[model samples]
Target: MQRGLSGQYEIGSVVGQEEVRAFVPAPLPPDPLPDLAGERGRLHEQALLACGRLDAITALLPEPDLFLYAYVRKEALVSSQIEGTQSSLSDLLLFELEETPGVPFDDVVEVSNYIAALEHGLGRLREGFPLSNRLLREIHERLLARGRGAERQPGSLRRTQNWIGGTRPGNAHFVPPPPQRVESQMADLERFLHDDQQPFSALIKAALAHVQFETIHPFLDGNGRMGRLLIALILHEDRVLHQPLLYLSLYFKQNREEYYRLLDATRREGDWEAWLDFFLEGVLTTANGAVETAHRLLDVFREDREQVEGTGRSAANALRVFHALGTRPVASINDLAERSGVAYPTASRAVEALEGLGILREITGRRRDRVFAYWRYIAVLNEGAEPL
Candidate 1:
């Protein structure tokens, strides 16, 4: 299945200097998709089952959006980390709380922007916006609204040659199409996305679209993060999942070398089958893990709530605080009071009651303005979310 030269190369000069042969990836919905009738078929079945399980779990959550609040932030953290951002989930939570201490402002801003971008995309989809190049540009704008790549022409495609890996195009591992060809290449991709004649499964379309986006390398910066985001966006758009619950960043990060190799292999060897296999496996693994995490979180919340209920007189106020913690795993007393609609002293006493029941832990261990974490809840969501 080694189809030579995935796309034609064109001679182009970079920065008015050396001429480089830049690669322009062929348009998406790759023809015939490597024949998924054997092993690939089995993988596809497993992925579908896993996705069904995830949706079932999502449906069971008391408030899926509340879970999504933290879950999406976790995804943002992991996705940004793959691009070398050092912000942790705690840092993001702290930043969102507007109490930034010992956190890299720029890194946290980048992660926050990622969350904003995702929310914007999901909102637009809900409003019946088509997933086209225009939406991608909009998401890109929000993604780099602040932080490292803000000045890299946030909402626009690269107007010059861009390369991945090495310093210059001449020494780079891969050089994307020259600037002039970006629009035409992207137009082809858009058509493929909207094409009704070519029938492909939602999962197959998502996998192929992700690789094509990455190979196109359209943006001046943030292409990697944007490409990853497109996967979830496509699935959500196609109604494959009710919510944006599946994220492959952790899987991709763990399999960094193979992931890159397969992407390159798809370009070099036309090994779309290998990449699709990997993509489907990631779907299965990530979906199954999400379902398991959801179950564990529900158990933790139930067990902690029962323990809080055993506190008698203080139970009502403490239960209020505990529910708040379920939504925001990390919070301050002020946060608890505001969210729970109680007085500061009341919030403090409620927090103490929960602490006595071993439901919440003081993360800072300070006298005043101390931060408390729903340790078990956070720990359940923190699995595989550690910054790499």
Candidate 2:
């Protein structure tokens, strides 16, 4: 349903410009509410079922947190990529290992901060903190803690006008709410988030909140990343998923053009139903994809363990090192030794054994301080994570 102009454009002024129209989005739950009926209703049900499946599949894993760790990094990479970062899943893993030789330091740092920000948010939520503006500020602070975005007023809401695309606010594709309107608008969003009187499901609420956050563009920087993160946070906070496993970054990245178009459509045409359709489809696709990846990782772990068992004499120690690599796919020989509680030589020989079996590969290509990657494991996690 075209509700017509979701919000009003207020007259504002920016540097080098005498006048600008900054959009202030209307409060959540959209007027007349979103039409989650007919085909849209069916899609919503299917998406919810898919999310349920994704949540349950974690029970089948040997260690759900291990899967969560890898899954979160993949999400961080893809989400950051949408914002024009060139970091890959491998680059993020390598940076975490402190082995950043040829890595794009700035890009990888940005991705790394995304991971930190997400972890911080999850931690706070786990401690029973409300998902309010304060929590968002904390997450944003960590997101821009270091690297290129360090000085963009990390934790605070923007006090100046910000635009998306184009050189200035005058010609930008979209100008978000002016500084004065941000707090009130965000407060409205927060009320909607905590309103149990809402008639929609958690999934629908998440979908709507994400658009509201992005349109508000409350933060000076990291708004895109924050908006995406908001989806996962909402789902987790509302107990829609048992874990933070469903991420739409890969879906959004793959459908980059359509994603942006839907967002703009919602603001310009007030076609909330259309954006909801696209968002539901993304949920279904991303949830199903995550389930598939979890199964593949399980298969790899099982088959590789069986292969190591065949080594006989050295199988015990080699298994230990492999187990450590399973937890952290990228590690050095010393890291393996310490993590596996084996001597340096034993860890070295174990690594060589795994290498011989074609299970692990040396990534650093250096004699000293060489880093090894659980290639197959990393490969499974790297799907659709290539930098754009």
Enumerate clash totals for all models, in the order shown: 0, 0
TM-score of model 2 relative to the true fold? 0.97
Structural similarity to truth (TM-score) of each candidate? 0.96, 0.97
**What are the per-model C-alpha RMSD values against the true structure?**
1.9, 1.8
Q: What is the lDDT of residue 182 in candidate 1?
A: 90
The C-alpha lDDT values of all candidates are: 0.87, 0.92
In the range 155-257, model 2's lDDT, one tens digit per residue, is 9999988999998888899988889899999999999999999999999999999999999999989999999999999999988887899999999999999
Q: What is the alpha-carbon lDDT of model 1 when measured against the actual structure?
A: 0.87
> How big is the positional error of residue 126 in model 1, measured in Å on the Cα after superposition?
0.3
* Clash pairs (backbone) in predicted model 1: none
Off by over 4 Å in 2: 1-4
